[model samples]
Each structure stands twice: as C-alpha cells, then as structure tokens.
Target: MIRFIDLGDQILEGQSEFAWWDTISDSFEEFSGNQTWPNWKCFEEDYLLDEVREMIQDMRPLDRYKSLFPRDWSGTFVSAEDRKKRYEKGICDDIIDEDT
Candidate 1:
C-alpha cells in the first residue's frame, strides 16, 4: 500500500525522505487496527505550499509562489509552520496511542 514517504515524493519534489518509517510503523502498531495508506492528495496542497516557503526566506507566501515557483506551482513547498503543525500533531497522536 502507498505510504507517507511515497506520498511525499509524489506530492512534493525531493520529499521522499521527509519522515522516518520506523517511527511511523511503530506508531501505526499502537492504533489497534489496520494501517491504511495516507491520503496523499489531501496533503499535496500543503506540501506544495511548504516547498515554496523553503526557497525564499522571510518572504510572503504569494511573493514566494510568484517569484520562486511561478512556473511550477504544485504547492509542494513545505513551510516551517506546516512542519511544526505536523510535528505537534504527530506528538499528540503518539501520546494518545501510548495512553491507549
């Protein structure tokens, strides 16, 4: 089945190694059910937004998109904010799993 790494790769260029599988697998084990593949499409927009945010520092979102990735606007850029959100979400999810 499709996974986060693969989803990252397809949705965002050069993002295949964004996360660690061992952690994901271990987390999945605690879910107490089958681990279905992630929904890549749902994340594609966020990923693209983040990728654009990476190239240009201290710049507005629209400016970055227009200047850095105008031709290739797939919203693949992952921003620091997005990463932080993901990290927090993961931590929360992990905690819940641990408690269960």
Candidate 2:
C-alpha cells in the first residue's frame, strides 16, 4: 500500500525507500525504511528520482478520471486541474500497489 505522510512524504509499504521532496532545500530525499542513512538525499541525476516522479505523474490523472460521472448524476464536479490542486494541498490519498 502507498501511504502519504503529513510532510509530503510518499511511503510505499514493504519498500526499502520512500520518496519526499524538500521544499526548503528544493531537492528530493529518499529515506530507507530500515533507518539506514536516514538523511540520504536523492539528487536529480539519480535514476530513482526520475522513476518516482514519472510514477506520481502517471497516477495523478486517475483521481480526476474516477471523479467523472457517467450520465445524469448531478453531484459536485471536479476537473483534472482541480485534482492536481488537491494533491498539492495534501488532501488526496491515492493508494497504489507495489507492482504498479
């Protein structure tokens, strides 16, 4: 399961590392689940950074798509861009399997 921490950390259960962006440093950090080298920073040149960003980007659209209604339901409507905003505010929790 994918879990999001209050500090914008994305934790993938059973995975050795978790991804998080550091706003103050303007960089990404990867923390080991085993608490080994807790301050390990993942640089832009790291392949893992690119992979995690791509994975997050790919999953970004799913929330918006799932919000769409089929035919005549008149409920609150949220656009794709809105979904992005919600994610920015840390209001949306999207769970993904490790295989994904």
The models' CA-based lDDT, in order, is 0.36, 0.37
Candidate number achieving the greatest lDDT relative to the actual structure: 2
For all predicted structures, in order, the TM-scores are 0.18, 0.20
State the local distance difference test value for candidate 2. Answer: 0.37
In the order shown, the candidates' Cα RMSDs to the true structure are 17.6, 17.6
lDDT of 1: 0.36
Q: Which stretches of model 2 miss by more than 4 angstroms?
A: 1-74, 95-100
Q: Judge candidate 1 at residue 82 and give its lDDT.
A: 57
Per-residue CA lDDT of model 1 for 6-92, tens digit only, reads: 334553444432221234235421111222223334333443455444542353333432333224334355544555667787843
